[model samples]
Structure formats: structure tokens, C-alpha cells
Target: MDLGPGRRAVPPRFVLPDVSEKNREGKRTARERLVVEREKQKAAERRRRALIVGASVVCVLALAAVVGVLAANSGKDKKSASDGPAVAPSGATGKDGLAIPVGKDTAKSSLTVWEDFRCPACKIFETTYRPTLHELVGAGKLKIDYHLVTIIDDGRGGSGSRQAANAAACAQDAGKFTAYHDVLYDNQPDETVDSFADDSKLIELAGKVDGLDTPAFRKCVKDGTHNSWVVKSNAAFDSGGFKGTPTVLFGGKNLAADPTMTPAKLKQMVEAANKG
Candidate 1:
């Protein structure tokens, strides 16, 4: 056991720590955490994209629903007589036998209405809602020029419109056009066969309305002198872009349909038109 001072016994052999299992486990845990974080980020991105797409789809559907609803409710209410432009009852027609109003003509308003005499809605417009517009006309707030279209061909084998036109023309000649106009609407038949074609019946109807020279009106109707005017009116109706009876022109604006054709809506449109 005696050793030199500078010499030292040989050191014992050192052994390395066995850490392979622990390192492997730690590596596995780190890899799993990384995978989990990546999965979470991917899921979040997918949810965000889905939300944006869903919102866009909902907006499109909402707009479509609104349009559909408006279309569905378009024809619900009939326009009242109080919702039209004005015209005076002055300025009578010729004294032959045609009826016309002779009054002081008013200033021109921006609204014009085109109508067919045989149209049911036109009759309703005259009888029910015309007074309001008449008052405006009388007050110089509205101007209504009646462009009479004959659509009787659609219903009465083409003769009804012709007869009515003849009668109207006669009324125009006698300066009783408006009076005769009212009479025709009052005596409108069921629009069926053999109803509006009878000449005798038309003569009888002529006899009922006052202010029309019976003899002249009868002769005018028999002679067909007023037929051309009716034909012209029908032709002009096409120029005005009318596709059917009861088509109305408001401030020169055309419409296939208006969901808001009532008095209130009409008033609004008129106001807007005036401003423009």
C-alpha cells in the first residue's frame, strides 16, 4: 500500500447514466403536444371560414325572400278614386251628338292615364277612385288626358269594342262624350256572347243618357263614322307600351306591376316625380 507521493492509485472506472428510455418518452411527449397544437389551429381556421360562408348565404336568402314577399302582395288592394291626377269638366265637344265637358282647362300635370273602356278595373277606377283626381283637376293640381283604348276584342269577338268606339265617337261629335262615356260603363254587360253586338240595344242605351242629341247619335252610330277614332286609340295604346287593359301611366313611368299602387303610394310617387 506504499505509493510514491506524486503517484496516485488508479481511479475507479466511471459508468455513464442510462437515460435512453426517459429521452425517448420526452421526445414522444413533445411530438404529441406539437401535433395537438397544429390540430387545434387547423380546426379554428375551418370554423372561421365556415362562419363567413354561412353569413353570406343567409344574406342572399334574406334578399330573395324580401323580393318574393313584395311580388306576392302586389295585387292586394285596389286604387281608390281619390288617388289620381286632376282635369277640369270644362271645354265641351261638338254639338252634333257627342258629349264633352266644356270647362276651363287646367295646367298640365305630369301624370297621364291610359285606359280601356271595357276594362273592369277602369270602371272601378272611374266609379270608385276618380273623384279624388277630379277634385285635383278642378283645382289645377292634376291634368288627366283620357287615351281611350278599345280592348273589347279580347272578350266580345271584336265587335263590342268597335260598337263602343262608334258610340263614343258619336258622343264626341255631339259634345256629350263624357256623358256617353259614363253611360257605356253604366250599361256594361257581362262581356259574354251576343250581349254587346246588338245594334237595337245600343240605340236603346243611347236614348237613356241625357244631353245627347238622340237623332244625331243614332245616325253617327249607324254610319260608323267614329270607328276610325277607336282604332287609332287602340293603336296609340301600343305605342304607350300597354300590354293589357287597366295599364296605367304615372308621370310617364312604365311598370309591369307596382306593389304600391294605392292612394298613399301614388301620392308618394307624385311627390317624388314633382321633385325630380
Candidate 2:
């Protein structure tokens, strides 16, 4: 050390430790790696969210499709039901399976009727003479046979006559033949509207009859179980050498031969036939 009176003492130089380039580069690389990892994680999170959204959309569409299919099937079932016929009354018997017999089979005098359900004239005849026939039959004077014909169907554009006859046969099976027969006349649709072709309407009419409309009855009607029988009956009617409907026969004699025959005259004819 030198004396310090006229000269400043020399100070020692202090040096800091130098950082290595490789170490700095390594720190920078580490920070960059962290940033890149964060970006990759963000990208992965976005992709995951998108996939979740897509899957949810697919599920919703699938649910909608299922609902649509169910609705379509339901509508188809109803439409199917609306496109058929009525059931025949149970245990209804006839000659050659053509005519459904009414009243006492053992009665002395017999009356046979050939009719079409959709015939307006037939409807009038039914409305007028049904009660009278019932009265005679109740008195053990006559038995009746009903032959269902479909001439009206052949002429009319729809299956009204056939369907109505078929349904009447079904009612015959259900023991409500008379009731349904009257109902058909009462609800006849202007002879031009073939509403009876709609089996749903026929079933609705069956509901009006007591102990007539039932599940089995509906099934029978819808299935057209007696359609073939009705066909056979109509064929028989044709083979019987008859052209028009509402053909009335008493003891194999044509009673409706007179075009202007009144209901009272009709009763009188039956009474005369019974006495003979």
C-alpha cells in the first residue's frame, strides 16, 4: 500500500460471473416449450368441445327421427283400421250360407227378401215393412229370410253396397242383425255416397247396436271375415234370375210384383198368405 497523502490509493476491480450462451438458450427453449404446450392444450380443449357438441346434435336428431317414425306408424295403423269392413253376427246360419233366416224357422208361411243395403228404395221398404214383418212373425204367422245383394255396388262407384251388406252379415253373427239392418237404412248416405266402404264408420254404427260392437266384432268386421260369404250370397242372388234389388218372395211367389204396392197392402198380402 502507498502513502495516501498526495496520491489516491488504487481500488481492486470487481467482476460479475458471465452467463453461458447455452444456459440462456436453454431457459428460452424451456419458456417456448411451456407456451407451445399451453397452445396445444387450448387446441385440444377446443376440439373436445366441438366433438361434444357434434355428438349432442346427433343424439337430438336421432331422437327426432325416432319420434317421427313412431308418429308415422301410429298414423298408418289408424289408416289401416279405417280401410276395412264390419263383423258378421255370431252363429248366423243360412241356406248355402247365402240367406240369413229370421223369425221362427218352423213357421208355416215364409217370407224371403233380397235387398242391397245402399239401395234408397230398399231403405224405404225396410223403413216401411220391417215393423209389419216383425208383427206377423211375432204372431207366429211368418218367418223371414234376408238375402243380401250387391247390385248397388256394381252400379255405384264405391263399395258401399258390398261393405254395408258385409257389415249386416257381421251383425247377423252378433245376433244384432235386425238392429244393424235397420241402422243401415236409417244412416243410408243418399245412395250416392258410399260411406259404408269406410270400415271405421261401419264400426261406429255397430257401436249403436246393443251388444254388437266389441273387439272381436271389430276385428271380424275389419278383417272382412264374411266378405267372401257376402260375395257368395250376391252370386246366389244373381243366379236366382233377379236383376233389381228389394225382391220380395212369399212362398216362392213375388209379392212386390206390384210397383205401387203400399205398406198396408204388403201386410194384407202376408196376412192372406198366412191364412192360406
Candidate 3:
């Protein structure tokens, strides 16, 4: 239909949306978000790994510091061990300075027992033969001379063996050497760990013995007043031509090398020696 020029029909322009362009823009946005999230995760992992590494380094440093401190203390103890003056317990002591008598000097038979406080075999022998020794000594049939050695300390480095021997000497001064000595064997620490290196443990053992927990005993042990005596005792042990500890001698004859020397056999030996 024809219309006048002013009333002519106009054609409308339809603008279709660009769907592919919109899809491309959405994909680009998604890819950018994924990249940002991935970067965040990587940063978090880096921080976690850094923290773990830092903690490990700190632990290693602490362990090294502890080891260093322990080494320094061990050296200090060794150096101070021989620095001070030593005291001896009063008794009919030995000329070699190692023998501590447990029975009368005028007894009919003499039995000498050599022991290292750290020696496991010595502990067994002491435990097995204690009853026999007590009976013989009490009956005036035999006397005992205890020689303490520090072979364990010399062969394997630790203050425990020497410290224990020194404490035994202190106990001797308090007249409770035998009691303290037995207790020490009864509660002997493992051979590797240096539990006896602490003087407090010796004082604790002294407390087990009657009248041995006195201030004098404590001071003697803490000051290592018998350390030099322990040194001399070790020298005597070297001079005795003994190969190992638990050396038992009856009437100046060694009984340890005899396979037949049981506790019962030891008692018989003491009786026979007394008769002789």
C-alpha cells in the first residue's frame, strides 16, 4: 500500500546478540580464575614446605647443642676428677692403698675379693656368695679384704665406675662400707648409662645404710675425696696381675679360675683353710 511521503513505512533493524563472542569471553574469565586458584595453591604449598624445613633445621640445631653441652660437661668431670685431695677410710688399710677389710685382721683364714662396681659378673658373685661370706666372717672362720678396681672406667670411658668406687670408700669411712657396697650391687645401673656418675645416687645408697647418711659422708662423696684413692686402687689392681674382676683369693690362692668353686665349695674351702 502506498502512503504519503510523511507517512511512509520505516524498516526496523534487529540486532542479534554475538553468542560466540560471549562464549569466548566466558571461557577466558574461567581460565583466568583457574590460573589464580592454581597460583594460590602453589603458594600455600610453598609456605607449608618452608615451615617444615625451618622446623627440621631448628631440631637439628637443638640436638647439636645438647650433644655439645654433654661433651663439654664430660670433659670437665674428667679434668676435675684428679684435681682435688683424697681421703682414706680408717682401718687396717693395705700398703697398695686398695684393700678395705670387712672382717677382723686376726681371723684364721683370709679371703680377698676383687670387684669392679660396674662389673656384672662381680655383682653375680657378690650376690651368690654373700651369705657364705657373712657366716664365715661372723664365725671368725675367715676375714675379707675388698679391693675395688676401675677397669670398666679405664677401658670404657665413664665416671660411673670410678665414682662408685670413690663413694664406697666414703661409705667405708662411715663404717658402712659392706652395707653400702651390697646395696650398690643390688641397685646397679646398666653398664652403658652413667647413672652412678652422679654423687646424689651414691648418697641415696648411703641413706639405705644405717648411720651412713651423715653430713660427713655426703660431703666426702660430693667432694670426690676418695677419687685419688680410687686412682691408687686402680694401680694396685693393675699390679695384682689380675686379668678380670670377680677375682677371689683364699689364703692368697686364687679361687676364681677354679671351675669347682661354687658358693658351697667356697664355704668348704674357708673351713678347710681354717683347719689348715
Which residue runs of candidate 2 sit more than 4 Å off their true CA positions? 1-94
lDDT of 1 by residue, 55-149 (tens): 68887979988899767876452211112322212342322212233223544444545555555445645553455555555666555555555
Model 3 lDDT at residue 181: 92
User: So what's the TM-score on candidate 1?
Assistant: 0.54
Per-candidate local distance difference test: 0.52, 0.67, 0.70
Q: Pick the candidate with the highest lDDT.
A: 3
Which stretches of model 1 miss by more than 4 angstroms?
1-105, 154-156, 254-256, 264-276
Residue by residue across 112-139, what tens digits does model 3's lDDT show?
8778887665665676578878898999
Error of 1 at 237 (Å): 2.0
- What ordering of candidates by TM-score runs from best to worst? 3, 2, 1
Clashing pairs in 3: none
lDDT over C-alpha atoms for residue 200 of model 2: 94
lDDT of 2 at 241: 84
The residue-level lDDT of candidate 3 at 164 comes to 93
Each model's TM-score, in the order given?
A: 0.54, 0.65, 0.69
Let me know the TM-score candidate 3 reaches against the reference structure.
0.69
Model 3 global lDDT (CA atoms, 0 to 1): 0.70
Better by lDDT, candidate 3 or 1: 3
How many residue pairs of model 1 clash at the backbone? 27
